[model samples]
Target: MSGFGNGRDIISYVALGDSFTEGMNDPYAESTGTGQERYRGWADRLAEHLARTCGEVRYANLAVRGKLIREIVQRQVPRAVELAPDLVTLCAGGNDIIRPGGDPDATARIFEAAVRRLAATGSRIVVFTGMDTGFQPVMRHLRGKIATYNMHLRAVADEHGCDVVDLWSMRVLQDRRAWSGDRLHLSAEGHRRIALRVCELLDACPPADWRDPWPAEEPLPWRAARQDDLHWAREFLVPWIGRRLTGRSSGDGRTAKRPELERLEPARYRN
Candidate 1:
């Protein structure tokens, strides 16, 4: 396991979790060998960083959108263990915690269990806290649950000797621009910031600081605000609710985009 400032070489890395780790909503066009396109999320960004510093690195991403903590633990964790990567990042439970009747404590327990299993493989494990969502008008109700879950996550990481990317404490992510129009996943910019933070956390490379504040934006007119909300509800919220009701998932029938260990691509950071 590599520690911060240890200057160790990371030859193999794997990412496991849900939409956030899957790089959802941060769309990109890539040749996945089936004429398929995909998003290059923080995991890919970090892999690029590692490759830059270490010459070459092997990487894999097993994340899929809409997976709950249990699903990820059951399906992805074992695969990650089989890979036995030198580095692994796990971020799950967000989809479960945001549900209407979800239990933060119960979810955290399962999350801790997943972490323990991954830690047992002796890979350097990195976990993340959900960003504070209190500022989002529609998602404000989830703030308490996120906070509680974060507490458990921190305690659990400490117990298992894992590194953490504490997104809950990141004030910059509270900005409205950091999120996508769905108010669920991060925007492209948000994913970039997360990649930079992960690089800083791992001491892989000195990328731009993730703490920089976003420039101010003029407030939208009352009419515009109403229209935006209506659009969001119709386009995103309603479908999410329908899926929940039907016991369906956004990740249903979806497989990992980058499932095997491969050489990292060049840095694609765009300032």
Candidate 2:
């Protein structure tokens, strides 16, 4: 708001990160879309909220799936600085922190450096801490590392006077339904909740409450849960490991979906 040279209006915004920001697994309602329009994650949802609230908002998302923190810093951060938008939201380093022998300290150093660069532009910067992974079977063991990195992240935000979206404390995300089938990226409901949370951090009136309670449902039987886990490992986890072994990324040869900031049109906003 203040950084936008206007009172309570973010005229322009740029998003930087990985699959989360890119809107993976959150496809458009009309069709299983392709290319730039395929996903509409939290950043896009936040932009929609801004357009509805602030009027004529310009938004850009320079995020790709499977991108590491270093890649984001090397590729997206410089471009974002050049754009010099009124606001920037970054949520990188998750890919790095989840890898084999990943060091949260090293990741935080790179993350902080990126934050410093963005802070210099006088734009309102918002950074996200990793979510509580204790609910995730595959990622639960790395909770300590994520928590360590989050501490450093908070310190970095404090040092730079940036707002922080502390996702670790977002109890809504711990719900199993908040995640996608692959169990890495968030589900559509998850993205919606995150968008609302980000809007709160930005001091904007979100379209709805992020704290809305999920409907109660019966838990899956023991055998069903085990079968689901096995299926997940076969379909998602194995392919992911294969990619790592072959040095391939889901984002290979991919570029930013919205590389340049553009006006957010009401007609383009999807539910």
Candidate 3:
């Protein structure tokens, strides 16, 4: 049993995405995973929630800020497969529209590839967040791109049997107050809303059971997404707050061994 002591086997979940998934600039995790810094973002909340259900679980935020779809397919996806996680959640594709310019075709292809690889794991459950509603809501072009990417992502997820959070659709009702000053990154409340939805999604559809370990596959190129740290939040609030909140200091103590992502490999598309 884990120190939390719910007396259940620990389930492992691997997150693959951009800054959002990594909890950047979210002012959430004051304690980093390795205990070097604070990781006061949605991932920590998700982990704390997992502890209550599964009791003890390992959740890896393999997401690098500013990550593009191609880099994810080649690197993060591969690493996630290596971990053989029970469930995988993705909150990527936004950077593909904003950073280094948007490449719709390339973004879609790589995102599709990443999903394919993750699905190959067979018994794994995948939760996907769309590519919209971040950055420069004024930039009609980027906003349009986000819409397009989300549509494409939906088709692919449906084809592969993956569940989606539809954050773009869910948060459309909230205004600038929910958005950070940059007009792109999410405000503290926005992130908490997203995190709560994730918990619901996970609980609504549990991961499928697996009998044997997943087989390994060829590695793809990995590109580390670049992102501005959005973790500096003056306000910290967990809405409808869960009963089992990981004590900030205690959780910090547990993450002492985590490693910060320094760099990611660049990758090109397959077609």
Query: Which 10-residue window in model 3 sums to the lowest lDDT?
Result: 262-271
Cα lDDT tens digits for candidate 1, 101-200: 9899999999988988888898999999988887887778999999999999999999999899999888888887888999888888899899989888
**Reference-based lDDT, each prediction:** 0.86, 0.89, 0.56
Give the count of colliding residue pairs in each prediction: 0, 0, 27
Winner on TM-score between 1 and 3 is 1
lDDT of 3: 0.56
Ranking by TM-score: 2, 1, 3
Write down the TM-score of every candidate.
0.93, 0.94, 0.65
| RMSD to truth, every model | 2.1, 2.2, 16.2
- Candidate 1, which segments miss by more than 4 Å at Cα? 1-10, 29-36, 267-271
Evaluate model 3: give its TM-score: 0.65
lDDT order of candidates, top first: 2, 1, 3
Off by over 4 Å in 2: 1-10, 31-37
Clash tally for model 1: 0
Off by over 4 Å in 3: 1-8, 28-37, 99-101, 127-137, 204-271
Output the number of the TM-score-best candidate: 2
The candidate that wins on lDDT is: 2
Model 2, 98-176: lDDT tens digits are: 8888899999999999999999999889999999989877789999999999999999999999899999999999998
Among residues 3 or more apart in sequence or in different chains, the pairs in candidate 2 whose N, CA or C atoms overlap within 3 Å are none
